[model samples]
Target: MSVEGGAGEPLSDSQKREIAVWFLTNAPAGEIHYVAKDVRALLGDDAVYEAAAAEAFPEYNKAHLVSLELPDRSGDIIIATYGELDRNNYLDPRTAQVATVDHIKQTCTKLRPAADEELPSAYIEEFRSALDVELSKYVAEAYPKGVCAVYCTSGKDIEGPGADFGFAVVISAAKRSPQNFCNGSWRSIWTMDFNYELQFVDIKGKIQVDAHYFEEGNVQLDTNIDCKDSTIMQSPDDCAVSITNIIRHHESEYLSSLEESYLNLSDATFKDLRRKLPVTRTLFPWHNTLAFSLTRDLAKELALGK
Candidate 1:
């Protein structure tokens, strides 16, 4: 297909050749992303889809920016490292809003709140009966006021491996406050590649969350929290003590299994890629209410096959 030129001057043949070369040589595998903003502005979405199917650019999913047609493009085409769009000229919400709000609404309809959804009923009954007490005891001793309640929640793992086999327990705070006090969680998930995250969340602040995971056998420990909380503001240092408290409180078979999963991996290559690497990730916080509504939509868009 002879793709038409962009609204403004589309990337020239030389520019396209240079971008493709740069991507091959320098860009990490499968990191290149292309949006339809330029072609869509010039022609329309129909044309953009045609372009998306082209071999020159495979597709990236759920980028929030590249959901469907990028809202607008300052320049017709983009070719850069990961998150280049969100970097300079394209950072404005008006410029890079993900597929419309209606697009998200239509997709998330009839969807139970992610927070409300429980792991398949059988799992919830078992988890509550087995581990709730230990979790509550741990939380109570760890923080002032401790935990008021703990409940199970179900969600698919966004990365790592497949759908979770069980529910995650939400440790609710005894002294709840709108601004400061927030809940915490101990989530054990997976069938084959078992993984768990013990997280502290500030529901009052948008995207206020901190997570910790100790790879089995104390081989590794990863902290996955939004850096904006402490790293950016330079307030409290990374809360290693919180993680110590969470794990120190509960010593259970379930938590042990999660540790084993992380510990006993056969893939030397994958292990090399993961050895002792502290995983501090940026938070994609969308309140407990929004949960996975938009994520589900973007997964559908990219055909991520969940």
Candidate 2:
């Protein structure tokens, strides 16, 4: 089996054998195994100690750095012994940043109003701070596992007179491991973005929003919402909860329609993508071919007197 590792002293024959034995004893199924990452979770603390003692590669402590690959239908299982540190020195803790009121205010300061703009920066900053706090609270409580961003303004927009408060909330996070062609290793990734915006205008006020939801590449939705009401300025808490609910409702609708869309794609689009047989194609006799080969082998063995 082929063995690969990061830059360091090459693994000795004894070390390679130790890694292989560790895999055989722990990961019998030959699954994608991360020694440092999974041993504690799947096997226990003792397994972690055992793995550390066996492999003895202390340079990279993270589990993603060390892995063993065992694929089905294989002659010699490929034993990936160790991994390398990121050349770019990238690090990810996989935790969402909790946005505080001070954090939001700092973000607002940099968004200076344009020249000849009459919009009051202080008023907008105050409004954004209030809304940001409420929204941050809602996100922290409702989606503990999700990340949130409050969209603020410098108080100068074509929406006319009143300010606009918007935010983006992303939930149901997952890890992505895309193959890194340069090193032939997988890279971990996560991302956040807004897809579309909806705006509403009226005599009282206006609310503009951008919403998006993504899950397992099954469904994606983009929609606009133009809501006009004075409640946005009247009660920041209520507006924060209301906007969150609106986004949630749209996300629910998008997910609910996923099954129907998948079925339609399977029935129509999948058929067009599938390969079709030629009109003149016919089935061949597979039983005769196998029998003839077996008979020839048997005859040869008999002729050899074995």
Candidate 3:
């Protein structure tokens, strides 16, 4: 609550507000606790940890910086930094340098090398090109009017074994300009949204993966590849090609259902707001509405009555 212990002065009102906004925008919605360095990176301010951690004590590893109670009253956000503890559960390894090394040691697995050591950068680019060609063809045949974009990734960070093979396809279509239909000036819209993300990870002796047709929410899958030759690291091209084929097959099978869902959302959900528009169905001059009176009385008459 109060700054002390030479960390620095208390955070200004602007500083507190910035910290809260930065945390909400950048940090994951499901997580509240964050380390000081993570806060520094997310906020893009190097001095945050010291100023915010001024209130922290040596006995506690977690240095509470910003405390915010949610508007919905579900819970609060306690933005803090947790110092690394040793095997005896003591906060001996408190510096950022030690924490960085510990993180590397934990996440850099044998099968998944560091980002720099993974397959050549050129190979990753090639993999991306292959995915784009194949996915673009599928999108063209499936949704002729829809705009498709592909993002390919093939690297591991200090967090986990990044996906050996991974890509995301985003399809956006059904543009609508509802300047007049909606209540306010922000009535412009584009209703259709469909995204597909696929990733494969090699764990132990098995290739953990699973296949699904279509899902409304985020979906993660796992499958077991028992064949030793299927390891992606050993045969990158063959594995990539095999994954692309699998994606094409799944997209072909379930894309129609996804389209149907989008159609239903547009027809049933969008129709409600569409019908409520002015009979002209044209852009309403909402800015001019302030000139009219709701009580159906002259201004003088209303004043006299009041």
Candidate 4:
């Protein structure tokens, strides 16, 4: 497009060539459209190509001024008061108001080189390595079975290899804790991957013991039947057996309880739980009430007989 103005002059072939070269070398990618508009306006259609010529052969107009359109969608354009026609003439938002050689130098300092450093990709790789190390440590300490499964979760439940491992740990742990007679009891295992990804396993079961009683009038009685109470002493073997039985008998209940609990958590509370879980650092940064609600539900389910 050409701009209409007085003192119109036909642009020389040399000037047109210069303007094209300046745009190819200095304009940001996909930004030449606005640059062309601005250059056409300042030089008028007749001498619009002069801007390009001027950029190539600075000797043409050492004191010539050029206009540039801002990349923002605000439709704002700026005129370069004085400078060689090149990227150096580009005005940055920071020094736009104060026009000076020094300001141009400062803007140049803020411009990024066109080379890609792959920073984001490198960061993600490092984070993943660290997460793997951490998960290995947890597996060694808690799940000697070598983390049979693992899962990853974010804004919503995500099923994967990582999540499967986490579920296994939950089942194993549930088979080890004491049960509650009033309801049930549970223990949860959680892991955080790098970038704040979270993984969790829920273990739920009941513990049973026998009750003893003494009659007041010339009679004493003790019941050997299994009862859900902490008052009676039971061997470790018996405890383990009770836990395994509870897990097998109430597997569906355990899952259902977790689902119900998550449903009850408010959005804010769920976020807090995700933050509080130590596993967040190893997992991607995703927080929601669903995770918290699940944990709460497991706690309630375990407390059933308590």
Candidate 5:
């Protein structure tokens, strides 16, 4: 657990741990055992609220804030909480912002314990919205690079049909590339197909990545080839076999459909074929150009050759 909130009145380290434990154990239940004021006191006046904020939401450091989930027997509900810590004043010794605390309290008040009468679907949207806000906030803070890996229980239709239970590693590295990487173009490689997107009701554990990099092109592909054989080159001629194998190994199911639809006999046939596929266009926005690569490159970069 880590302290949260603003600079002057943040929660202490111990308090943060305690709050995190409590939230983990008693989530999805509109219940808060510790009082905000009490947390404020424990953190000491100098860092009271900030400490409490950190403890109440360790995910802040990682780019997430704590949220409370309250489910009625018939419906689910949630509320989000955020610290008063401003990025501009991150290193300053300012006190907690009163507005932040008020906002949290107001959000919390809207939630109520589960009741037996409401329909399950009645509050589903509301619950999801609240959860999203909290989750997004936490993720944004914790993973400024927008990369995260989440692990969850796997099962066959855990929630309902078309639902497969399994842990997921969410790697969100969607950031505006620096000028050197793309002349100010916002490029990223973690985009996903509509059907491949993941949904989750609850998440636990800290998100971690092996490495992060900023390069001109798809560093992920580069790293993948490099890992298999250090001599691999960015040019197709230099690593034709490796590149071919890589493409073959990671072939998209949609590629088959595209190839069949457009039968052109030329060296540039594959490129043309790919351009015609909506799936390919969406997933490979860079069109074989510079794009962010999360795991493939990060893993190799961390494993060898610095």
Candidate 6:
């Protein structure tokens, strides 16, 4: 976590309000989002508290320093933990902030015992469910420009370990001008080329798998920032700058949602996966490939060009 606070020292009441106001600005309103800077104009500066919260939280978990829901709201939607500090006659603001921050950090922000990339963090022992690291790639597949910019975070451009967002750039390129996401096939695909773990919790909270990869494929967490196919932006630098501005304005569970979903998987599910991926061993002796089809009729979709 890049942000830090004096965990042992108590904060003044003024500091706490500043932090709360800071959070209020970034809080989501339905589908509309807020930029911290714009909100800060009205709320004043308190990123320090957020930084402290980040300090209190673990690495990777720092992104979720502000996960609170007002009331009667949870799941992937409205996120605010404490009630209006005004209405609650119980805990003082600092006390409430402490309790809420502490509770959230403990419940959420689990680390994915990642021994290595190429495999989903869930594959590691003592691992709990985590979003596919390549979720940015999937977001890119869906939103291309908008959502991908918010979530995708990889490549030489990002200065971190996130191929998902980097791949979102690739997705944007294709989306901005579909003539090529660099030629369409997996051959042109650089991000999310691996057959990593996949699962989703349903309304009843059952874990279900859509696919898993073949054991013999090469999963590269490419961070070179080589794929620039978007007509939407100028360069990788522009991609990062542009998209980060978008994120400051909006948010998706890019953080705590995974924390909320973290759960230990039964040993049995690992024993029985319904599908295998990267069934393209013919292309490269290394291409252990196969896999998804949700759109259109199965037949017509299957009939599209390879």
Per residue, candidate 2 scores C-alpha lDDT tens digits across 1-306 of 234556755555455556644653442111223443454343334543454444433222122222211122111111111111122111110111111111101111111112333322444434435544654454344332223333332232434334343322222211122221001111111111211132331111111111111212211222223332222234445545555545444433333343234324333343453443223352222222322222233223323421
What is the clash count for each candidate, in the order shown? 0, 4, 4, 39, 40, 18
Instruction: Return the candidate ranking by lDDT, descending.
Output: 4, 3, 2, 5, 1, 6
Task: Kindly give the stretch of ten consecutive residues in candidate 1 with the minimal lDDT sum.
Answer: 227-236
Q: Could you tell me every candidate's TM-score relative to the true structure?
A: 0.20, 0.30, 0.26, 0.15, 0.19, 0.19
Name the runs in model 6 displaced over 4 angstroms. Answer: 1-26, 29-34, 42-306
Q: Put the candidates in TM-score order, highest first.
A: 2, 3, 1, 6, 5, 4
Query: Which portions of model 2 show Cα errors greater than 4 Å?
Result: 1-122, 137-144, 156-172, 177-233, 263-267, 274-306
lDDT winner between candidates 3 and 6:
3
Q: What TM-score does candidate 1 get on C-alpha atoms?
A: 0.20
Error of 3 at 34 (Å): 36
Residue 221 in model 6: shift from native, Å? 36
lDDT of 5 at 227: 14
Measured with C-alpha atoms, the lDDT of residue 86 in candidate 3 is 34
- Per-residue error at 292 for model 5, in Å? 11
Runs of candidate 4 with Cα error greater than 4 angstroms are 1-122, 146-306
Error of 4 at 32 (Å): 67
Deviation of model 1 at 182, angstroms: 28
RMSD of each: 20.4, 22.2, 20.9, 30.5, 21.7, 23.0
| lDDT for position 97 in model 3 | 16
Residue 268 of model 1 has an lDDT of 49
Give lDDT per model, in order: 0.27, 0.29, 0.30, 0.30, 0.29, 0.25
Model 1 off-target regions past 4 Å? 1-35, 42-107, 112-119, 125-306
